[model samples]
Target: MELACAFLARNRMEEYELLRVFFDSKVVREGLSELQIPSPLGRDVGGFQEQWAGPLCLDGILAGLIVNGGAYKRYRGPARDAKVLAGAAVEALTQNRFEDFRVDVSHVAWAPWFANVAWDHTYILTDTANAEITVLCITDTD
Candidate 1:
């Protein structure tokens, strides 16, 4: 995940997109494949889909930071959970104590990659000096 963060820090957007796709595919293939299934008599289990479970506010913050010109890089690191990191970041940002960084005004709430259950925690870091942002995601399995 540090590699991903470096790529984003360098503003290599295309490579970052490719990396994100690769990670997302891996999560879907490996993570979702572990789901338990019970046998049924000639029953077909179709239309299976995985989604990130979270509220809209966090999702919007992530999108604005990454997609809408905020230029946030992602870094995976240790944490208890994503919710905790997000809540802290949100509170700090809301209270004007988030290291002088401001949230983008555009509203968007769909970031499937952030919902990947493979990660347990995520942190967004910003370098005010260089105007760079990094996101750190943590997990025990990896």
Candidate 2:
């Protein structure tokens, strides 16, 4: 896996297809080298974003490496603020009978960091540092 990663970094973008052929079958199905077929424009570019370090190394490697997972980056949040004990509250917050709700966010925190709050109702986040909250409704069940 490390060699595959280094090869990607060392080779030209035009050569990615070659590497795809050598990857595991599961990887191929999950949009590794080729795109799906039989529909609108056939498919889209689905594979590693070369610039993102996380997916690049953690994709096939790091299953049991490092601590739990192989994470190689910097986190600069207050230690306590990063700890989230609000899974139940978060689930309740996005619960919907007619919608498949999901939390498409990270680095999230409630207004009062490390303090107890009714996560089921509301929580403040630093998305964009001073961003507006946007709610999206899904119409598909994939």
Candidate 3:
């Protein structure tokens, strides 16, 4: 439910035509990218720490991030590049706070990956800052 809403919320915001391809639940497929262990650490700078989840869809962004992630094979060129790029827009939308919506927005942890996900006003980022990641999970929403 949370993942679905995250993607839907972004789609509503971007208002792009190609994004419509992801709109249909029937066409949606379960997709998950496994963690690639031994990744270069991201700097928290000043002991940064957080976890945000609930009604957030960071799938598109995540897919692209992992697809191009240096730990794996570089996605070739334009065509594949375009697909990966789509994740960015969705990611941007996830970066906002629903607490400010002034309307009801309910989302839950559901089945967590690594049993954790980060949520703020924008996207749900799984923390890999301190450890190894071998898989990332994406799935068809319920």
Reference-based lDDT, each prediction: 0.36, 0.26, 0.31
Tens-digit per-residue lDDT, 56-100, candidate 2: 222122122112221234335443333332322333333321122
TM-score of model number 1: 0.25
Give the alpha carbon lDDT tens digit for every residue of 13-127 in model 1. Answer: 3434623342245443364343222222111122111112222255444443333221233434433344456566656544433443322221111233333333333443433
Task: Report the lDDT tens digits of candidate 3 across residue range 1-142.
Answer: 3443454345342233222232222323243222221122222211222224332434444455445544335556654554546555434433344232211111223233322332211223321222111112333222
Count of clashing pairs, candidate 3: 22
Model 2 stretches astray by more than 4 angstroms:
1-3, 18-44, 52-80, 83-142
In angstroms, how far off is 115's CA in candidate 2? 32
Model 1 CA lDDT for position 75: 36
* Residue ranges of candidate 1 with Cα displaced over 4 Å: 16-19, 25-89, 92-142
Identify the leading candidate in terms of lDDT: 1
TM-score of each: 0.25, 0.21, 0.21
Better of 1 and 3 by TM-score: 1
Candidates ranked, most accurate by lDDT first = 1, 3, 2
